[model samples]
Target: MECARKDRDLEAEQALWQRWQARRDAQTRAELFDFYAAWSRVLAGHYHARYPHPLAEYADFVGLASMGLLQAIDGFNPALGSRFKSYAEPFIKGAVLKGLACYIKDHQQTSRERLLSVAGEAEEGDDLATIVNLTVGLAFGYFLELGILDAELYDNDPASLYERENGLETLAYLVEQLTEGERRVITGHYYQQLSFVQLSEMMGVSKARVSQLHGQGLQKLRRLYEQVS
Candidate 1:
């Protein structure tokens, strides 16, 4: 009886995937998302439990995991003969890690900015020197924190290193396939952490243009990812 029930559930899920893939049915996709919502949250909770960030709440991880879950749903290939959960786990984890990385980076940048602001406002002589020293100490601390976090996130095992290298190579290949404008926007925004406003100023284009390029670039990347997957 239990086996029969499980089979029925699997059949229902397979039907949903077929409808979404064939027709890009919005309702089917939404249903799939709702069905897997709890699973996404469980994955998020697992990561949060392992690596709790002071600045990031559990809800934040859940939100990031949802983005990953959506990507998984969109990119998943039923023809690949792999279970959806198996394929989606990596995407979901990657999204959470990427979000955590961005959060830490932003926090570090903010700390540096605050330090610089303090140094700029400090009185000349001993006060200025003290502020500079404090800034240096804080910067060093942030650097160490990043190093430790990275080490914790990525294991030193051979399999892990190989997987990381392969993932980077795949990403590089995908980036290379982008148009010049899209390439610039994607690289500058992601790698350089430049905002659309900053990219606009640097590229001598309007912010709207930068945003459009960014959207186009991401769309292309998504298609490329699906192809490769």
Candidate 2:
């Protein structure tokens, strides 16, 4: 019942948006504002929590994010056959970040290159960022040539499976098939750059147990890859 009600609300909202889009209605602007205002605040909070500038307030971030949300709404076309939420969320968040960047540029007198360098360093070891682009996911993308992951995987398109290899999504799905200990062992070893000894220490298990987990994970990954291929 709740799901049906939510769906009805969404249909109504989209219908209203379509009308606003046609006539450029002022009330439609207000409706968009009311709908996304709280979301803007939440996204702004994420920036505020991690941003380097101490003087940057939550309200300021919210204002910046809200502009991004508005831009998304203005540019959106229903004919694209894409979900508005999916397309708009990234656009809004990107706008907020860009706005913050501009503010930083004006206030700090710092170069954009320096800010990018610092941000890069902060996200260097994060797994989600590491595996973000499928192109990079194959050969470990950006981490390639650094000996972080095997180089052969880079030979294929990370986005599409031309060679019938397991790719990133398949690997993740396979990991879901693993026992928790096995998953941790593999993630720590490859993704987190932890040695077997380190994993053993962290998990409060023997080195042999860690080795067993690693073996299990590898086996599962191999099977999954073979099945996909």
Which model scores highest in lDDT?
1
* Candidate 1: 10-residue stretch with minimal lDDT: 144-153
lDDT per residue for candidate 1 within 27-126, as digits (tens), equals 5665686678668878888999987888786656776787788779889889889999999999999988988987742445434333443233345566
Listed in order, each prediction's TM-score against the native is: 0.45, 0.42
lDDT of each candidate versus the true structure: 0.67, 0.57
CA shift at 61, candidate 2, in angstroms? Answer: 1.1
Per candidate, the number of residue pairs that clash is 0, 1
**Candidate 2's error at 211, in angstroms?**
68
Candidate 1 whole-model C-alpha lDDT, 0 to 1: 0.67
Alpha-carbon shift of residue 69 in model 1 (angstroms): 0.4
- The prediction achieving the highest TM-score against the true structure is 1
Q: Positional deviation of 54 in candidate 1, in angstroms?
A: 0.8
- Which residues of candidate 1, in runs, are more than 4 Å off? 104-229
Root-mean-square deviation of Cα positions for candidate 2 versus the true structure, in angstroms: 17.5
